[model samples]
Target: MSKKKEALLAQYAGHITEKFSETPNMAFLDKVVTGLGPAIYNRDAALVSGSDESELETVKANFLIKKLGLEDGPHLMHAIKEVIREYGASERNKYRAVVYYILARRFNKEGIYK
Candidate 1:
């Protein structure tokens, strides 16, 4: 990994550990970050807006359904809401990689990264 990527990964790992009190699987997290591509370097793109319904819909449609091949249903939205809740409603900087990591694991889609 590049130095910048490493730094960002470390920063994200810290957020996961400190905020969620979970020790992340480094390999999985690395793949999640790498999969995110250049979007991670963009400040606005890197963050998930829990308050935006459209943004959440995009995550469900694009990431969950399209990327992970999950079927469309109410449960998907419920899962997204659950993740946002877990991330904390009041939390402003909900990193996209962390959110994706949690969702990927929630649905047992880690193999997609492998």
Candidate 2:
């Protein structure tokens, strides 16, 4: 939430919008990335008030599930792993990559990466 970070996330959101145009819900994607960018940057506080990594992942996963309208199932878990695999190469923040891919998939059912 600093102005600099906001600017970065805004720029990033725009990049994603253009780069992943195949994805339909640009607005939602923008929101997700914008909201998550801060969380990812300040991951310690973003994940949770506490300092446990497991708790952090749990909180992040739950947030993604609710935000993306996904349910708890094998498919969801599979998709989460796939998101990590596909986007993890370039993205140092696995949580950000996971959230990005998941929301991208939701918005662009056909495939956003294409």
What is the TM-score of each predicted model, taking all chains together? 0.95, 0.50
- Give candidate 1's whole-model lDDT: 0.93
TM-score, cand. 2: 0.50
Query: What is the number of residue pairs that collide in model 2?
Result: 0
Residues 1-114 of candidate 2: C-alpha lDDT, one tens digit per residue = 477765645555544444444433445544555556546566653323223446545644665455554556666555545544544355443445334545455545423223
- Judged by TM-score, which candidate is best? 1
lDDT of 1 by residue, 13-87 (tens): 988897678899999999999999999999999999998999999999999999999999999999999888988
Stretches of model 1 off by over 4 angstroms after superposition:
none
lDDT of candidate model 2 versus the reference: 0.48
Report clashes for each candidate as comma-separated counts: 0, 0
